[model samples]
Target: MDQGIVKLLPAVRGIAREAGEVILRYYTDTVTAHVKADGSPVTAADNAAEAVILPALHHLTPDIPVISEEQHAAGKSPPGDHGTYWLVDPLDGTKGFIEHTGEFTVNIGLIKDGVPVLGVMYLPVDGDTYAAAGPGTAVYGARARHDVPISCRVVPADGLVVLSSRRHGDRERLDKFLEGKLVKEHRHSSSALKFCLIARGEVDIYPRFGPTCEWDTAAGHAILLAAGGSIETPDGQSLAYGKPRYLNGEFIAYGRK
Candidate 1:
């Protein structure tokens, strides 16, 4: 990444935090959820969060076009013709948020030359923010916690700590994938936050067989990479971004360095 682009990450993280606050604002109330054309849920939180993220992102990097969920819900298209852009999931885990699980998050990712180079994931309920850009990664926990640099730990000799999607895990596929692995523990989770967990080495791996959009994983993907971890296919290829329609296929996240 360019030094200038790396410098923009702090501002981007701040914007994601602001958008997370918007989510919290709606989270505290009885917000309604609506179904989009694809049968996915959307809520006031998603829109409000995007309203905060989109403009601030463009302000931070005027040349980058932002591709966000709500914007596409409004019929906007991705400017794939551009060499660099942003992928924003103003509110990730809408179902979790709607169910009041406190698992929802705000995701902001910067894509340069078709790869995610910067990412920020903010959890609103507790105001925890995890960010990664150029050469390193960091986390800002809530309650006056000092921002701390973070990295993925090498897998311990004991066993693997596996994380599965709380909302969309394919149990059979996962079982088959882990058939011969020494699994010490497993957790069910929702959203890109799982990627953050792997980034910080709290979890060792995450496998997703379900469908997901680019924005859904881009931010956390960047963070995981910066933490010296990786998100890749079962066959071990790094997930590439800016594909047609911004869709993503099955992939696995690994915490090992």
Candidate 2:
């Protein structure tokens, strides 16, 4: 684990929380959604949150370039990638936020050489934060309490507790993917919070068959890895970042085996 990355957890977590607070300010009022070029919805909260995160990250790690959802969507992305860069989804689960599901989150992750080394995910509605930097650093924090350690749990002998995306993915594909597995319970979740749940051992597996960008998964991916969990393609290869247009493919996130 890089000590430099470890040292970054605190500031990154603060940045995430700061963005979450910005989102909350808009979330409390009427959140009007507008369609982007890709036909996905974007709200004032998302832009407002990104407005908070981008400069703070630049001030914190001036050399590390940031690839943020709103900026990328607007075709304002920086040219070329640094070996180390910040991936920011100021407000993930925009659909859930629009629907008032209270499942949205603020995400920040540091990717080093195509791997996520640090992350901070903040749930604005509840003031809960999940974060980590390298192995053994995973933690769950809240407004009143901060840095309570957390890790993934081994799958139980009874069955696997699975989570599926609430608004995306094909149900047929998910069912086929789960065929023959011992599924004790299945539930729907929004945003990157699925990865946080798996990181804290609240769930066993989350299989993502839907389309997602790199920013969507990076933060949660870092926290889950720190918690002794893993994310991989269905064939069991490590997921790589820094793809063209920052896109992602289908993958499965698993807790401790």
Task: Please tell me which predicted candidate would have the highest lDDT against the true structure.
Answer: 2
Residues 1-257, candidate 2: write the lDDT tens digits: 89988998888888888888888878755779999989999999999999999999999989999999999988888899678999999999999999888999999999999999999999999999998999999999988885799999999999999999878868899899889999999998889999999999889999998778999999999999999999998889989899998999899999997
- What's the TM-score of each model vs. the native? 0.95, 0.97
Show the lowest summed lDDT stretch of 10 residues, model 1.
Answer: 134-143
- What C-alpha lDDT values do all the predictions have? 0.85, 0.92
Please give, for residues 58-174, the per-residue lDDT of candidate 1 as tens digits.
787777788998898788855446578888898999998988889988999888876788888888888888887755755545646878888888888899999998878778999
Model 2, backbone clash pairs (residues 3+ apart or across chains), number: 0
Top-scoring candidate (TM-score): 2
* Candidate 1 lDDT for residue 207: 90
Which regions of candidate 2 deviate over 4 angstroms? Answer: none
Residue runs of model 1 more than 4 Å from their true location after superposition: none
